[model samples]
Target: MIVIINYGSGNLKSIKNGFTKIGEETVISQDIREMEKADALVLPGVGAFGTAMEHLESYKDIIHEHINNGKPFLGVCLGLQVLFTKSQENKGVKGLDIFKGEVMKIPEEGLKIPHMGWNNLKIVNECSILDGIENDYMYFVHSYYAKPDDEDIIAATTNYGIDLTAAVCRDNVFATQFHPEKSGEVGLNILKNFVKSIPSK
Candidate 1:
C-alpha cells in the first residue's frame, strides 16, 4: 500500500482525499516501520521549508533508503522543495538531498510573490509520472522552486514571471511543485499516473 507521510507539514486530509478519489487506498503515518513497508511513499507538504525539514529529520534515512531501493516516491509543493540540498526559504537548513539542487524564491518582477493559480506546464523530458500529462493546467501555490544541478531531471516547467520548475523526475523520485491534488481533474489524472508508475507490491 502507498503511505502518505504524516510528517506534521502536509495537508494530510486533502492529500488523502485526492488519492481516495483516484481509487487508490493510502495510509498516512509517521511510523518508521509502516513507512519502511510501504509500496510507495507520497510526501505532500504545505509550510515553511526549515520547519518541514526539522520535523522530517527523524525519517530522513528511511526516505533515502526507500528511494535507494527503487521504490516509487512522489512529493508535492513544499514537499518538492525539500528534495533539494537547500532552500532560499530556509537559510542553512539542509534538505533531503535526494536530488542535487537548490530551491530559490520566485523572482518578484512585479508578479506576485507566491504564484497562486493555475499554470500550464511545458514538458521538458519524458517521465513515467507524467506519462499522459502534457501542457495541462495544474494548481500551484509556492514562493520558492527548485533548480536542479542536472537540468535533465526537470520533467516540466511553467511560466510564472520566470520558467519555474513545475515537476521533476529522477529514477524512482518524482516531485511536483504544483499541487496535483488541488488541480481538479488534471491533477487527479496526474496522481493516477503516479499510482500507475508504482510497481505492484
Candidate 2:
C-alpha cells in the first residue's frame, strides 16, 4: 500500500481522495511502524519549513531506513523541499540530507511571491512517474524550490524568473514541487504513474 506521511500538514485529505479516485490503495499515517511497512511512501506537506522538519525528525529513522532500502518514495511541495540538505525559508534550517542540495526562495520577478497557479513543466530526465504525460500544466503553491547539486536528478523544470526544478528523482526517491493531486487529470495521471511504479510488497 502507498503510505502518505502525515506530519500535521494540510492537504492530506485531497491527496488521499486523488489516490482513491485512481483506484489506488493508500493510507495516511504518522506511525513509524506503518511507514516502515509501506510498499511506497508519499511525503505530503503544506506548511512552514522548520515546523515540518521538526515533525519529520521524530521519525527520521523510519524515513532513512525506507530510502536506504531503495523503496519508491515521493515528496510533494514542502515535502520536496525537506529532502534536500537545507532550506533558506526557515532561516537556513537543515533538511533530511537525503540528497545534496539546498532549497531557496523562487525568484520574485514581476510575478507573485507564492506561485499559485497552473504552470507547464519542461520535462528533462524522462522517468516512469511522468510516463504517458507530455509537457502539461501542474498545480503549484510554494515560495521555495530545491536546487540539487546534481542536475541529473532533475526530472522536469518550469520557467518563472529562471528555470526551476519542478520534479526530481534519484534512484527510488522522487519528488515534485507541484501538487499532482490538485493538477486535475494530468496531475492524477502522475500519481497513477507513481502508484503503478511502486514495487510489489
Candidate 3:
C-alpha cells in the first residue's frame, strides 16, 4: 500500500483520488506506525515552508526511519522542498536535511512570483518515476525550488528565466517540485510509475 504522509499541509484528497483513479490503493495518515508499515511513502504538501517543517518534525522519527529502511519514497511541491537542508522561504528554518541542498525563491524578472501554470520539464537523468514520459509539461505552483549539492540527483529541470530543479532522486528517495496529481494524463502516468516501483519482497 502507498502511504501518503498527512501533516495537514498537502492537497491530500486530490492526490489520493489521483492514485485511486489509477487503481492504486493509497492511505493518507500522519500516524508513525502506519507509515512504518507502508510499502512506499508519498510526501505531498502545499503550504509555507516553516509550517510544513513544523508538522514534519512531529513525525521526524517516522520520516527518518522510513528512509533508513530504504523504502521507495516520493515528495511533491513543498513536500519536495522540505527534503533539502534549508529554505529561504522560512528564514533560518532547517529542512528535513535528507539531501544536501537548499530551497530558494525564484528570481523575479518579468515572470510572476508564484509560477502558477503549465511548464515543460527538461529531463536530466532518466529514472523510473519518469518512465514512459518524455520531457513533457507538468503543473506547478510554487515560489521556491531546490538546489541540490549533488547534481546527480536531479532527474529533470524547467526554465523560467533561470533553470530550476523540477524533479530529484537519490537512491530510493524521490521528489518533484510540480504537482503530478494536477498535471493531467502525463502526470498520472508519473504516479503510476511510482506505484509500480514499490519493492516486492
lDDT for each of the candidates? 0.92, 0.89, 0.91
Q: What are the TM-scores, per candidate, against the unseen true structure? A: 0.98, 0.97, 0.97
Q: Higher-TM-score candidate among 2 and 3?
A: 3
Residues 99-149 of candidate 1: C-alpha lDDT, one tens digit per residue: 898999899989987899999999999998888888999999989999999
lDDT value, candidate 2, whole model: 0.89
Residues 101-137 of candidate 2: C-alpha lDDT, one tens digit per residue = 8898888878898988999999899878898877799
Worst 10 residues of 2 by lDDT: 192-201
Q: Each candidate: how many clashes?
A: 0, 0, 0
Worst 10 residues of 1 by lDDT: 192-201
Clashing pairs in 3: none
- By TM-score, the best candidate is 1
Question: Could you tell me which 10 consecutive residues in candidate 3 have the lowest summed lDDT?
Answer: 192-201
Give the candidates in order of lDDT, highest first: 1, 3, 2
> Model 3 misses residue 63 by how many Å?
1.1
Q: Arrange candidates by TM-score, highest first: which order? A: 1, 3, 2
